[model samples]
Target: MNAPAGISTLDRVKIFSEITIKTFDILVIGGGIMGAGIALDAASRGLRVLLVEKQDFAAGTSSRSTKLIHGGLRYLKNFELGLVRTVARERKVLNRNAPHLVMPEPMLIPILKNASYGYWATKAGLTLYDLLGNVETPERHRMLDKTQTLAQEPLLNPEKLQGAGCFVEYRTDDGRLTMEVLKTAHTFGATCLNYCELRHFTYNEEKRITGAALQDKLTGKNYQIKATCVINATGPWSAKIMQQDQPEKLPELVHTKGVHLVVPFEKFPLKQAVYFDIPGGRMLFAIPRQGVTYFGTTDTPFTGNLEKPRVEKEDVAYLLAEVNKMFTGLDLKPGDVISSWAGVRVLLYEAGKKPSEISRKDEIFISASGLITVAGGKLTGYRKLAEQVVNKALEKYFPENRQPSGTAKIKLSGGDFENAAAVKGFLKSCQEIGQLHKYPSESLAYLVRNYGTNTKAVLKEACRLKAENLDPETRLLQAEICYTIQNEGVTSLSDFLIRRTGKLYFERGQIIAILPAVKAAFQKILTLGNGILANQESEFMEQFEAAVAFKNESKNAMVSA
Candidate 1:
């Protein structure tokens, strides 16, 4: 890999070698959003950091989110002003600092008979939500009468519809945002490794936490790493990590399973995001995204293994039944679904409360043995939570030294994308160039959006390789797949399709069908032998098939049986 233009790869072999010599200021476990943010914070502030992910970044709860960067307007219904304000403020920071990915959007909260929140209450909450965000962005809330509301969202259930309140917020590609965070952390020199398993830990004689043992999933090689401080951001696996050090250091982790079902854009094609309550009091979101629509999610408590979660028949039936009620024409059956996925959210150890009622507010715990654990927050506020945790680590490490602050203002890799006119001028110049003129003009717009300021490198790389006969599965190019392997740390087809590109999440069928070509591209650039490539492809296809089988099995399985 050529380091992906501006981003840097940590060279896991080198990081592990030094760590085996018991060298590192910090050891970070679970490289999801929280850990990634903390690693960037610590690295930028001059702490030698190593972050290990048991799987790929954002492969778990982070990717399974509703994919919104908005403040929790629902929390305002419960009068949780502090949490609402906290997340709302974060929305502003992310929008400005990561503008290429995060953007403003309006949400429609349809009011109806026997709704949990009536029109009056919803309006009050939206007003407070706007106040909390403090107008960092132009979009805000507006009240819509029945006819006007129905016009705004034609698919919405208008039968006795008391009207709607439109409020502004943010949405993003969750996986992309997570990757950008990790990439930015790498830019600041945080050593990161995916598919690295934490075997155990090392402790000082005085019972201070020292380091850990890690196994590389690629080569199955094991290594030991020592650190002055250890932070666990393992999400659902937090309990597993803690019990490795002390049997009773922390309580057991509670797992909550959520499922998202993707459908065709024509099915709903909502103009704005909708937050409608299902029967009883639970709420489900119908969000329009990237030429498709998805509705979810059931927050059912689970005791199943966290390694993999299977979407149950009851969850699908419940979601469909609920949405069908709000929208009479939906009538969405199992076959209408394009794709579905289930993920487990690790809730804090609790006695009797249901997972749905569990708070999304994050908690930080420092044990007697000096291990820090962060758990239970949404995607919008991960960076803020990390800012708090890193401040603690720095005060403990440097005592009197100063550290750089203001991560909220720090621009991410592609956030500095030039203004629209500059982009248009560049495109005009590219059109005039003889070498670039032959490239597909239609794809120029999509290329600019996906690659951001890095389009220059991709186009330049395309010119350099001059690999003709490009075979792209969807919007992405086969050459771009090669570039991803040669530059981005894409080891498997899954990483490239699902994370590096949105093909899997957006068009999973093409990903399953084009495995051979994707692997061929991988082989061409990485020079991977057939045996290694074959094994990887087979497992990915099996996983994909298993996912399909899971969906079919749910359709056949009984909800109560």
Candidate 2:
């Protein structure tokens, strides 16, 4: 595949050869947010770095988050103030750096008569939250009376609605955020490859860790890459990676599954995002994104396949029941769910505590063999976690000198806007460019918001693609697919639909309609044979069906792709 100029991993044949021949200061396993952040931090500070993911970047838990760069208001109840403070501060940093990816949005928390946090408690909590987060006045928490709350979001059950508390929370596309971070790392000289699996560890005479043997899943070839340090940043699969080195080590991670369901906006017409209470004092979020509304996150102990977490009949029923109970007379049913996603949270194991009660604070563990493993962190705190990992490696091994982290102010790729206001103006300009090519305004707006400064390249691709015998929608999809394949290291259809663009979860109908064009693009761009194309198409359909399959059908629809 022909990658955009300056992207290192666009040429996999070259990258594979480089991985085998060159030695790196740090080798990061897992290409999710943590590993990507670590790669960015280490590479930026002038370290030779190599990062490899068995799946596509953000294919795991990183892309499946609630997609909020929040301050962890619920953590306040657990008295995890430090965690909240750190993540709260990170929210601001991310919004400033990746303004196009992460933006501030108002979150409404209704105070009910029998709510988990009452009027006074909610007020005190939000006040403290603002102080802790250093929230600005305009976006600070505002106490809304019943009338005001109803006017803002009339979906709330009026029987016990005491009031509401509106505060700022950052919304983002988790997968895109991860990709941008990794791309920045690549620019800073990090060699990254997806579908590369770590086979085993190699050691010297002292029996200490030296390097790892990796198998390229794409080519079915094996290579040994030498590194001074190896860090395991795989979220749910962290323990599995650790045990490969020390088979006798006990489990340190507890896997908890969280499920989110998406329904059409008309079915559940929510004006704004809501954080409402459910049974057992738990809370669920109903956020409107694009054109659909998604609500989720049922946390429960999980012991299933880590690659693909199934959304069972009970999972759908639980969310629908809770959402319907919290809102007015809108009796939602299982069939109303357009699509859904389930991700496992790899948390630190705590004795005698429920899944939701476990602390979200991340912890680092170093084995005697010199393996570094990071576990149990929220998406908001990835940068800090990466800094800690890199600092630890430098201080312990390279005691002679250490490079201070410089990623605090580094702008991610495609996030070159000066501020949020500048982003809006860029969008308008992009709309004009798309209109000149006879493209729809909404499609161009979506592209600009997601691709940021890279929208120019996409628009150019759309122009070039006009020669092809394709519809407007197919041409647009092909353009976006071409760009991701060239720049984002997209190898499979699932990577483009699920992780790169989020079309599988948000726009299932369009995927079904445009899949023929998508498959054709992949086949031509990647030069895939008929067998490979068929296999990839089958795998993509399994995932597409799995997203909407509910009840007994869900079990049959479960796939390990």
Candidate 3:
């Protein structure tokens, strides 16, 4: 089948018009990782699918993850062997399919004298972890003595460091992964819309759900979309959507907030990804990427705004304290943080469990109104969650032509390479294009890593705009902006900066420097007026500042006094 048309503003308007006029086989609410996976799965099965997101794809928990595609080795501590195995197997599948995006990174688990897990206990756990997850012998756990561990990553605290566990874990760009899945779903003929809000559900005489009332956040125009099946994969907002259907039902989600802080490599200089425990036995990661080290994830109960979860001063203090304790040589402080992000996890409401203790296992709820809702899943398990959700939908609504999920065998968008070697060869070839276009080797390699097989398309666009006489960096940025606006449904600058490319997290300086050029390019291509451009810029800056800000007025005043 032919690939679907690129997702521009015009394409979005076209899709809105089409979905408004016809009934679809499935209407998927929320365009995060899980929803994107569901859309792809259903569409690959020959079902007409429509997916809508209130914001840009992966603008929530999906984008704000710890960015690991690992087997959830930590879950084994709680005796969740099944989840560990499932995520480990899925990690292999993701690495096989999206080699350019999913990469194997060596993780170091420091064994301190006062560490929660002793040397032998940690080894036993890791051994069981490897066995249950079917880890290859070569890629399995390795016991690193204190000298070897410190040699690998010299920043570790050596005062009481007994040894470490070195193992392989898959790292990924979560937002880009979600986008590729959504794009692949579109390729398979699923119509998807970002920046589209769901107003309410439409029900038939028996009160069974039949359709959705959606409003385009950009155009402020409303449209009604009819569908035979509607799946609610709204992540943290699943409770809100379910409440709209059954107001009497108690809320089923416990919102746990996780935050990450990014520090330049010069300050921390972590050579490998380290998963170390804090004072309270909770684990956090400090992974190095693009000349920076980022670590996170405090699991506190969140009662704040879901749309804009800001990193608080306490959150930063907690992370910095943990990092300093583990890496004693690094005297890191809140001031060292250049950027940060907070995300809310919509975990199942298990009575009497702490926030971190809640299970990451996904659960699906089918309301009496025929509204199918899925909640409480990790990013690593999105495909299986989607497969399960679609299977149930098919059994209930389309039993006559039931089909199993094809996603496992098929590669995601831009992930058609046969193996990791093929990906390396492709990247090596891309360097020639970079040389021809005067693009830096590093920038081109970054694009290849992020876009995979689609790197050529972006390069072609960059070549087409070579006459613009842009700087090497600006040219690369322009090419990405052009590709995103023309093909990736980037309705706003924040979408392009934060989700499409992770400039907000990794390339903050570049984003600020090229903001004007990017804005002009979007305006010229999408015909966005000055007012819209200004609003988008303001919103992007506000979000950028909120993510990085660490000082609270009240706290600062008390400290000073």
Best by TM-score: 3
Q: TM-score for all predictions? A: 0.91, 0.96, 0.97
Worst 10-residue stretch by lDDT in candidate 3?
A: 1-10
Tell me the lDDT of candidate 1.
0.73
lDDT of 1 at 340: 73
Model 3 agreement with the true structure over 352-404: per-residue lDDT tens digits: 88887778888888888888999888899899889999999999999986678
Candidate lDDT values, in order: 0.73, 0.88, 0.87
The number of the candidate with the highest lDDT is 2
TM-score preference between candidates 1 and 3, better one: 3
| Error of model 3, residue 52, in angstroms | 0.4
lDDT by residue (tens digit), candidate 1, 1-561: 113433322355565566576577888898778888888788878788888888877787777777789787766655668888899989878877666577777888898877677888888877878888786445778888889988888887777488998877788877778777777777777777888889888888998888888898877999878888899998888877777777676865678898887778887667778888766446788888767788888888888867667766677778878777777577887767777777788766666666666666778877777788888877898888998888777777556647766677666655563444555565555545423336666455545555555556666666655546453222236556655554455678777766666665567766656766677767876678989888877766665664545566765665646
Ranking by TM-score: 3, 2, 1
Lowest summed lDDT across 10 adjacent residues in model 2 is found at 1-10
Shift of residue 299 alpha carbon in model 1, Å: 0.5
Q: For candidate 1, give the lDDT of residue 397.
A: 59
- The segments of candidate 2 whose C-alpha lies over 4 angstroms from its true place after superposition are 1-10, 552-561
Winner by lDDT between candidate 2 and candidate 1: 2
Model 1 / residue 370 / CA error / Å: 1.2
Instruction: Please give the TM-score that candidate 2 achieves against the real structure.
Output: 0.96
Cα distance off (Å), candidate 1, residue 130: 0.9
Residue pairs with colliding backbones in model 1 are none
